[model samples]
Target: MLKRRTRDFHQLSPVANALFHVIAASLAIIAVFPFLFVLIISFTDENTLARNGYRLIPEKWSVDAYHYIFQTGDSLLRSYGVTLFVTIVGTLISLCIITLYAYAISRKSFKYRGFFSFIAFFTMLFNGGLVPTYIVVTQLLDMKDSIWALIMPMAVNAFYIMIMRTFFSTMVPDAIIESGRIDGAGEFQTFIRLVLPLSLPGIATIALFSTLGYWNDWFNALLYIDNPDLVPLQSMLMRIENSMQFILQNSNNASLSSGILQNMPQDTSRMAMVVLATGPIILAYPFFQRYFVQGLTIGAVKE
Candidate 1:
């Protein structure tokens, strides 16, 4: 009877449940309001925005900001192509390396697991300084002015490998590996055919992290890439933003025509850049939602 009665111990009372719902809904709105406002402001007319300040509903709407961004459609498309290639390739490479390293360390049977784990964990605490890293990439590897400059720099992360290791250690049962071995499967075959299928949540979590890191990485491009053709979407957008700021700062210069400054969609263009940068990544979240939540919760909890 005591065991049966314990089932309701965790249940919320009606009033408490209603209060939680209200609080959650309120917090969700508070979090989402800024992004929605930015999207609205991006469509607002620049003159009206300057005149009235920010408003949920603007006096006038315009697509001139988007038009400015798409002014050179070919260059925009090329940058998009480069960014897509980097994100996809980098994420896949990161996942492969992280999972393999993490799985090896998670296994108790692996003789050198402790040594390799220390190596991975050690990287999290320290790294070669920027100058040395730059020298390695440019002089040693010779990836300067190349697309590899963008992808290779962010191809592995020690923190992500640790997360995956935690997930494997806590969530995967030893019996599964034993069963595969008993069925005459080799180590590589067992990992590929059995383990990977059950590890989707953890893999999805790592993949999303890797994808975001690669997509948003412009610093590497700034460091190693000199060729305009190798610039990713984020780098290109950043360059455009810098050019806009320069023009605005020097608006009073006699060489610059007043008409060009007057017609520039400065405010709206900044918001538009946010929308373009974040839109695809936001769409990607839904696909990973189920696995991502499960992975995070399970990976964090240790027996």
Candidate 2:
């Protein structure tokens, strides 16, 4: 009778259910408001923006900022290409290396798992510092002014490796692995055929994280890329920011022709650039969100 009463209470907890839904709604608003503001501001008119700060709804609307950005279209388009290339290539390479390393460590039979894990973990706690690492990358590796500089240095993160290891350890059953072995499947073959298919959620999570990191990266470009042609989207955005200030400071110059400089909407352009740079990720979120959430939950709960 006590067990039945407890079960009834658990199933019919309206008060608790209401509180959970309220919290969820509040968090959804908190997460969505900033993005809403950004979207509204991106389409807002330059003159209106100059007079007023950001608004939830635009007083006046225009695509002048976007038009200006896409006018010549070479710089923005090239930067986007660079970013896309880096994100896709870097994420794939990082995922492959991280998954292999994580799988190796998750194996109890691997003789050097402990030592390798220690090496990976040690990086998380301590490092040679920025100067030494920069020297090695720029001077030793000669990656400066090259796209490889952006991709290679950040290929593996220790925390990500640990999460992958944790996921493999908990989610992948030992029985499946033993069966693979019984069928004469080698370790590599088993990982390729069996382990990888099961680990898609975790891999997708890591891929999204790595892709965003690569896409939004400016630090690598700031350090390694002096060539304007090699500048990624974020770095190009930084350049545009500085250019806006330059145009505003020299607004009275004779070269400031009627249509070109006078019509340039500096304020709106900045916001539009923000939207342009971030738009891809926002659009991409829906596709990976399910896997991302599942991966994080699986990673958080230990066996």
Best TM-score among the predictions, by candidate number? 1
In model 2, which runs have C-alpha deviations exceeding 4 angstroms?
1-26, 249-262, 290-303
Instruction: For model 2, state the Cα shift of residue 126 in Å.
Output: 2.1
Kindly list the per-residue Cα lDDT of model 1 for residues 1-303, writing each as its tens digit.
787678778788999999999999999999989999999999999999999999999999999899988886787788888989999888888899989999999999999999999999999999998999999999999999988888888888999889989988877888778888999998889889777777889899888888899889889989998888888889999999998999999988999999989888998999999998887788778878877666445432135
Candidate 2 lDDT over 38-131, as tens digits, reads: 7787789988887787777778999988887777469889998999899889998999899999999999999999999999999999999889
- TM per model? 0.90, 0.83
Clashes of 1: 0
Say which candidate scores most in lDDT: 1
Residue 53 displacement (Å), model 2 = 4.3
RMSD of each: 3.1, 3.8
Decoy 1 TM-score against native? 0.90
